[model samples]
Target: MQKVRGVVARAKGEPVSVETVLVPDPGPGEAVVQVQTCGVCHTDLHYREGGINDDFPFLLGHEAAGVVESVGEGVTNVAPGDFVILNWRAVCGDCRACRRGEPWYCFSTFNAEQRMTLEDGTELTPALGIGAFAEKTLVHSGQCTKVDPSASPAAVGLLGCGVMAGIGAAINTGAVGRGKSVAVIGCGGVGAAAVAGSALAGASRIIAVDLDDRKLEWARGLGATHTVNSKERDAVEAIQELTDGFGADVVIDAVGRPETWKQAFYARDLAGTVVLVGVPTPDMRIPDLPLIDVFGRGGALKSSWYGDCLPDRDFPMLVDLYQQGRLDLDAFVSERIGLDDVEAAFERMHHGDVLRSVVEL
Candidate 1:
């Protein structure tokens, strides 16, 4: 066993602190990773708010890149010294999703069998099964996807979560491609990434919509052809005007709210795709809309889970693109911070000023 300083949320609505955490040696199907860079994700903030569950004293970071420190028996997918991005989806090859060749939706994904604990021996519930806001963390071997060592750890680590989700929402779920007209609602990290993904897939017109002009500027840097300040005008009408009175070919709802979702539903050309990538609270229901409209004007209505990405296939590929300069992964990282700065980072989330604040261990 080894002890490391880690960010821990001891209770709901309380500040997270760097605590002494005990990490066990990896057991079967497990590996210990020395985290190099971990992005301050909104999900981590969600865990702290008790919004995810009553799982208290949670270990609070997930989007991370690291090096393998040790592996348990029978592990061969990655090894010590390998550069990797820690993923939450460790697909069970025998699950129904995997057998049918859609392992990205693997219903039986696994995590480390053992637990990391506090000095008093209380178990820590890791956010998304990856508690990487520390010097080292334990995870299922399958969660460690090997990527190019040459890429910046801070830049590529984001592929583990929001960045990947946004990109995947565009390329994989929305099927955005050459000459497609796309509009992504919510110009946050994920939305910006969707804009970038549309460009990467050769989309002709990419319109970015957000309340904040700052985030809209960030979207432009990432390849948005036009910007829409939805707070100033109706999102659907602006999207229609930009798309020549029709609508976007693909509309992504990254805001995950009833109003934004309805806008996305209307901001599409007939037989166009609408993707819901934003996470909505349990109480939030689908907005009141006619059932006939859903049937009449739809190519597809889809909800993107992890952007329907298979990390092993996607992570390395995206990292390679970043390494080659075809994809500007670095633009998403607005600030570099230390572990102690996470609480302040979480506070910064409310204002929506930053794209990403990455913690370098």
Candidate 2:
């Protein structure tokens, strides 16, 4: 066992406290990763608010890049000293989804079985099963995807979750193609990523819609062809006008609200695809839109689960693309801070002022 410094949320709606915890040796199909850096994401805040579950005393932090420090008995895919990105979904090969050759939908995805605990022996629940807001984190061997060591951990770490989700929303879920016109609503981390994904997929007219101009400017930096401040203009009208008055080939609702989803629905051309990457609250409901609209729209209205990404296949390829100067992962990292700054990072996330604040371990 090893003692490592980590940030833990002791209870709901409480500030995370940093403490030294015990990380046990990896069991079968597991590995110990010495985390170099991890990004503070909105999901971590969700956990703190008990938005995810009642698993209190939670060890938060997940989007991270690290070095494999050790491996369990039967592990062969990765070993000590390998650079890797931590993924939450450790797909089980024998699951029903994997048997159908769609491991991305693997229902039996899991994390390290061994638990990380407090000094008093209280069990700590890791966020998304990663618990990366620590010096070291234990995870399933499948959760560790090997990547180039030369890449900056702070930059590549974002790919483990939000960045990958956004890119996959367009490239994987939306199937954005060359010269396709795309519009993405809510230009935060996820929305900007969809814009970048569309751009990388050779989208000719990438329109971005957001309530904040600051975010819209950031969206343009990430490859948005046009920007619309929805606070000042009708988002659907703006998107439609930008896309030849017929709307885009694909419209992604990164906001995940019924209002935004409806905008996404009507903001695309006939038979256009709508990808919902944003998450919604349980109290929220989509009350309007006739059933005929669903049938008449004529294309897929899909929800991207973690951008529909298969981590092993997507992470390395994206890192390589970043290395070749084709994809700019570094731009997403607005700042880097220590573990203590997570609470402040959540505030920034609320203000929509920054893209991502990474914790450099």
**Local distance difference test, each candidate:** 0.95, 0.93
lDDT by residue (tens digit), candidate 2, 7-59: 99999999889998899999998999999999988899999999889988999
Give a tens-digit lDDT track for model 1, residues 202-316: 9999999999999999999999999999889999999999999999999999989999999999999999999999888788999999999999996898999998999999999
Give, for candidate 1, the lowest lDDT window spanning 10 residues.
Answer: 346-355
Q: What is the lDDT of residue 229 in candidate 2?
A: 90
- Per-residue error at 43 for model 2, in Å? 0.4
Q: Candidate 1: deviation at residue 183, Å?
A: 0.3
Q: After TM-score superposition, what is the CA distance of residue 55 in candidate 2 from its true location, in Å? A: 0.7
Using TM-score as the measure, the top candidate is 1
Judged by whole-model lDDT over C-alpha atoms, candidate 1 comes out at 0.95
